[model samples]
Target chain A: MIRFENAHIGYDHDLIEAIDFELPNSGIIGLFGKNGTGKSTLFKTIIGLQALRRGNIFIHHQNISEIPGKLLAKKVSYCPTQILSYGNLTVWDVVSNGRIPHLSWLGKLKTHDIELVENSLELMGISDIKQQLISECSDGQKQKAIIASALAQETSILLLDEPTAFLDYPSKQELLKQLSFISEAGKLIIVSSHDLDLFEELCDLKLLLSHHKIITSEDTDFNKYWDEFTTKGLAK
Target chain B: MTTGKLTYLLLGLLLLVLFILGIGLGSADIGFMEAIKSLFKSADSSPEAYIIQELRLPRSLVAILAGAGLAVSGLIMQTLFTNILAGPHILGVSSGASLFVALTILAGSTLGDMSLPFAAILGALTISSLILFASRMLSSGTILLIIGVMIASFCSACVSLLEYYADSSALRSFVIWTMGDFSAVGKTHLPTLAVFVMMSVAICFAFSKGLNALLMGESGAHALGFRVKSLRTWILFITAVLAGSITAYCGPIAFVGLAVPNLVRFIVKTANHQVMIPLVLLTGACFGLLCDIISRLPGDDRTLPVNVASALIGAPVVIIILLKYQKSIR
Candidate 1:
């Protein structure tokens, strides 16, 4: 379980303050917010890249801020919004890097590591494209490759920022389905994306950040606020 | 054989052939058999032996070491910055070394035979650490690259100013140093340059896996549990030691550091640093030996500077790589 207690997170100052929430331990949580409303900052804080200015983050009942970087990596896998700039890596090579935190300093891959990488590629249905360079992979294939890499990390919580960006409509739906499947397999998957209706259909819960407060699907007036948001967006 | 292994075997054979030619076919042509025989004889045993042991052997080793050092350094910088244009000199490490050496030459400071090398390492470390610190403040790689170029130019301006104030003989010596030479490396200094180059190469291999992880960019590598800052620092340090030592010993040999990696990558067709590390080193040594042979102007008393030979070869190779990979550059 990941818990944020009165967390105020941002680059220089608070974009969102006094955030208190406990993410569902084993399910897909879709995070939605308008542009510039601290979604990325919140993700960074949870990934342990940014510090919470005022409060504490607990992971499995332990304070996250005190966790060492390598140890933290074993618990959370993060995929950024942008395609990685490296062009030379093959899909298999990229997946292999997911084992970095678990390997010795020399990064020698053992039989177990190789098996895990193969398993991840198989799980994502990217086994056929394993030898393809990342530069050659289609948007959907690249998205799957990235997810496979995250899975290869074997983290309990996977954080993806805009995983469906640049993906086609059908590819977006397919990716969300895969994400939901993975979540059901017992990992906490938190994703932020602009595909709202699809995200809502697939995610087990929603963490809606607006007006400097986080409102979850469990809140009493959650549907009323969600309908108000839809009306506001449609009115705009 | 696998492409990587074949590349190594061919490069190794080429380096051996070039090494033999480098020693045998100088301005004064000695027979191949005589050169080989003299290499094993004591330096004082014969005039041929003296030439082989004292002059030809050391110069050949220097060429190989400098070439390998510069090429490997360039590869590391290119990988670290994730930019093809990045080279040992681009980060101002070489320029900083040049500035200090220029000052030492102008001031006529004699700290025995080791003054120039010591001073160059000091200057390179100083500038590289500054760049490392600036990298923390500047998040963009492009901006950091620009900053490095600006620093290099600033150092060049300082060198020019020093040149403007220097006397005739000092200016001449400084100009020759800038032109670069493998021939200046003597029997006494070869061991030190050899030690430095070999040590840097070892460190690079030790960091090879981390370097592969780094190709994914900083945030990506950090997420993989890499200490990006420390890895970058070590890379800069290794580059400084390699480039700084080579500059001190051979006077800023160019193009080899910037071009060899690209050439190797094109031929080998893989991004695995495990394969690249050895290939680049061997290819670099071959290139250096070839450049030295071209510069020697066989049987003539006069010879061209090895730096000129390298740029003559390296510039075109880089241009070709850029043309083929234009879309990848940005």
Candidate 2:
């Protein structure tokens, strides 16, 4: 379980709150927040890339800050908003790089490692284009390649920021379907996304970041609370 | 083999021919047939044999090492910055070394081989410290690059100042080194240069995964379990050594670093640093040797500096790379 306690994050002079949050035991959680709600910063903190002004982040009951680089990789994975710019790498190479945390500086993969990479490729449905250069891949395929790399990491939890931002309507829905399918296997999945219509159908939990309310069940009255919350904010 | 492997192999073979040409021909003009005979047995006793063994052979080896070192440095710079055009020169490490070298000469320090390389390395480390400081404190790669270039231009200005004040002898030596000449490398210096190149190349190759992780940018690499800060530190350290000594011995050779990694990526199409590292080494050696051949060809009474030759060649290749392959560099 990933847990955060009174995490106070600040950028330059401005401070985001000292808020506490925890991962639910199962399924997809939608981080529903407008731009500049500190969602991206929080993701960086959870991944142990950024230092916290207050509180601690615990992964699998162990503090994430204390883990080594390779070990951290074994436990957590993240997909950022910015696309990677590496020259001349094929789709196969990018996905296989997920195994780096498991390998040594001089490490090459064992057969099991190769199998896992193949599995990731197959799951992402990118096998036919595994040899295709990244420069040659389409937008959807490129998005899937990023997802495929996350899958190859085989972490218990996956964190993504705006995974569907550049994708088309069908691609967004397809990614939502994929995320839902992934979460069903008892993995903890969290994605910060903006597709409210797709989230309603596919998400198990909805978190309204700006308003500070979390809806933990599918049966939660999102419509009622959302209307009331927006009205209250306007009155202020 | 795939096209990538086949192209690298051909490049390797082409490098071998250039290597032979490097030993066979020079300003003295041994001529190919006689040079081969001299290799077998002092050329049936020619002054040519001593020149080849004592001068050209070591010089050629230095040329290879400098090329390979600069090439690998370019590879790491591109990976670290996540920009295709990024290289040691672009990032100002080379500039830092250039300034240090100019200062060393200006300070009345008549440097030996070891001291010259050592001073250059120290200078490069200083620049890396500045780049790292910006990368950590600012969280901006672009800012780091801009700062680096600013420092580099500052160094270039200093170099010009040094050029103006120096007497003819010092100025001549400085000018020759600046143009990246390998013809002056001595037999005694080859072993140390060789050891340095091999060890640094091994270290650079060892960081292949870290480099690949780096290409994905810092945050993504952090998630994949890489200590991104540490990895960047190591890569920068290795690049400094690879580039510094080459600059110390010869002068700052350009574009080979900027060109070789892109060239390898175009051929290999695998961003995995594992494959990219070895290919970069091979291709870098190939590039250096080829450039050396053009610089040292028989017609000129005084051989051209390798840098001048590489720039004439490298400028076109880089332009073509940018013009034709716009999407790949990204």
| The candidate that achieves the highest lDDT relative to the unseen native structure | 1
TM-score for each of the candidates:
0.92, 0.90
lDDT of 2 by residue, A1-236 (tens): 77777767646632456556677766787776666767787778778787777777788888877877677778778888755545676788778878878886685877888899998898778999998877788777877888888888888888888888788888876777778788888888888876666775677767665543343334357667655645665311
For model 1, residues B1-330, the per-residue Cα lDDT tens digits are 376567778888999899888899976668988999999899999888899989999999989999998899888888877776678776777889889989998898532258888888888888878877887787566687788889989999999999999998889888888788887778888989999999999999888778877876666677777678788988888888888889988987778887898888677555657777788898899899889988986458778988889988998998997786665566
**Positional deviation of B126 in candidate 1, in angstroms?**
4.6
Predicted candidate 1 versus true structure: per-residue lDDT over A57-120, tens digit per residue:
8988889778887888899888877555343557877788788789886677899999999999
Q: For model 1, how big is the iRMS in angstroms?
A: 2.2
lDDT digits (tens) for residues B18-83 of candidate 2: 878888877786787777666666633668888777777778788888788888888887777776
Docking class of 2: medium
TM-score of chain A by itself in each prediction: 0.94, 0.87
Error of 1 at A146 (Å): 2.4
Off by over 4 Å in 1: A234-236, B110-112, B126-151
lDDT agreement of model 2 with the native = 0.77
Residue B241 in candidate 1, Cα distance off native in Å: 1.9
The ten-residue window of minimal lDDT in model 2 chain A covers A210-219
